[model samples]
Target: MRWFWIDHFVEFETGRTAAAVKNVSLAEEHLHDHFLGFAVMPSSLVIEGLAQTGGLLVGEHYQFNERVVLAKVSRASFHFMARPGDSLTYQATMQDINENGAMVAGTSHMGDRLQAEIDLVFAHLPSRENDERELFDPADFLAMLRLLRLYDVGRQSDGSPLTIPAHLLQAEQAMEAATDLN
Candidate 1:
């Protein structure tokens, strides 16, 4: 099973930057066991959110052709604890990208207050052509992106709306239809 920390993207630009938000609530199961009464969000989970924000920004550069994984956390620092009713917004800016991997600097903020800063390095693992299955199910990933509303507010630096390729959309629909039949 996959777990997504970000609720949706408020801004996204290919090979550039992205901004996303995550709402912390008391109802979350993790909060129950995490220090009981003082249910502040854990620092590790906060870092995970930042990683997700940056990882996707890197993967999108290659049109998600390769598996982009968190290679290293070069740096991470937290200014304060995030409590229920707080909304953490993550901003990620790409530093560099190459055949080997990518680097991104990300920050988590609650309104104007800085909560955390993270520097991440991602390793892009190429797919083996000899493998029968596709590198990844673009369809499923597209659906997840749609659910994240990345397409809703995503735009390029020129202010034009970001558009997902038609082929990827078609692949997603086909995959969904096949699942329905089973």
Candidate 2:
């Protein structure tokens, strides 16, 4: 999915915490169907935004080599409605990390109002012995990292432009083709 929340990292410290921001705009298409007059951002997408930010943090910490996905949400709560013209700040802190998985606690705030809180767990898939070089290029990883503004984590030693992997590029192309066909 295209990132619903195009977040930019404001603060990041590897193995510790990270903060990102997403500005809500009335021009966003989802707002049209969300509510008639009151275009409050959907809670599911808010959680997704937080998860994507948090997932990027964890993935970058591990050098984007492992196949990581959101395994579970331990706890999630929403307090206030996120409306258009609001800028949401999402902050996530690592609770624990291991070779197999990691946990993070995250909170989203709209100015002084708490919008949502979540505890997320992520699972890592190890590379197989003979899996076509694992299909993870450092350049592609770096590009995704940069796109997510996660390269500021002090872990990227080489500052190089990221390259998209051929496999992923092909998959995306196929998806586009299918959409066109449909």
Best by TM-score: 1
Best by lDDT: 1
TM-scores of all models? 0.91, 0.76
**Candidate 1, overall lDDT?**
0.88
RMSD of each: 2.0, 6.5
In candidate 2, the residue pairs with backbone N, CA or C atoms under 3 Å apart (3 or more residues apart, or in different chains) clash, namely none
Candidate 1 C-alpha lDDT tens digits along 150-179: 888877678888778676888988988999
Whole-model Cα lDDT of every candidate shown, in order: 0.88, 0.75
Q: Count residue pairs with overlapping backbones in model 2.
A: 0
